[model samples]
Target: MILYTTTPIEMIFPCDQTVFDNYKTISYQGVPLVVEQTDNHYRIVQILSSNPNDFMKEELAPGQLISFI
Candidate 1:
């Protein structure tokens, strides 16, 4: 997987709850996000963040996908 540090930390998964739980929160001086165990099927660029409130806004939903070129 690639390591993103832009405004919107782009990820290729839907923030896996199980996998995410394994990781401790890392300070970034910016928005923080995690991959959902429910969205491990994705294999592209899936952006996630703490500001958009995907969890609260359903921005990522249970399974969100994105394409990377």
Candidate 2:
């Protein structure tokens, strides 16, 4: 079936609560980001900054792995 809706897919097909447990919002290098914890680093989930320049940084790109000190 073809489903057309503005609602996010996650809301339609809810994910497990445990799936969200590893995700968190943090300020990295003064930029707000949503990241998922991996073995030794965090995988960028989303950039929450309003500044366009924030998106220009390759290190902060979504899906990039970052090690937090």
Candidate 3:
């Protein structure tokens, strides 16, 4: 999964869907998401949004973007 970190999209290990609980919205800009990527890699884009409609679940792909409230 990838997330928009102002500086860069820091990749984490063991990106299993089960680790979603370990992700905290307050600590992160968004939630734990599962995205489909055949390349085994993804890109993170940073965009400011209020009360992001995104919720934590699974992983997210390059196309998936979350918001932070």
Candidate number achieving the greatest TM-score relative to the actual structure: 2
| Rank by TM-score (best first) | 2, 1, 3
What is the Cα-based lDDT of residue 49 in candidate 1? 58
What digit string (tens of lDDT, one per residue) describes model 3 on residues 1-69? 666554323324446655434333222335433332223333223323333554322233235434432
Best by lDDT: 2
TM-score of 3: 0.19
Q: Higher TM-score: candidate 1 or 2?
A: 2
Estimate every model's Cα lDDT from 0 to 1: 0.38, 0.85, 0.37
Regions of candidate 3 where Cα sits further than 4 Å from its true position:
1-30, 43-69
Question: 1 or 3: which has the higher TM-score?
Answer: 1
Tell me the tens digit of each residue's lDDT in model 1 across 1-69. Answer: 676555333232536655435432322224343332223333212334546554454434434432222
In model 2, which regions exceed 4 Å deviation?
1-13
TM-score of each: 0.23, 0.78, 0.19
Q: Could you tell me how far off, in angstroms, the CA of residue 50 lies in candidate 3 after the best superposition?
A: 12
Q: Write the per-residue lDDT of candidate 2 for residues 2-69, one digit (tens) a residue.
A: 78964347634648877678788899999999888989999998888989999999999989999975
Worst 10 residues of 2 by lDDT: 5-14
What CA root-mean-square deviation does each model show from the true structure? 12.3, 4.2, 13.1
Give lDDT for model 2.
0.85
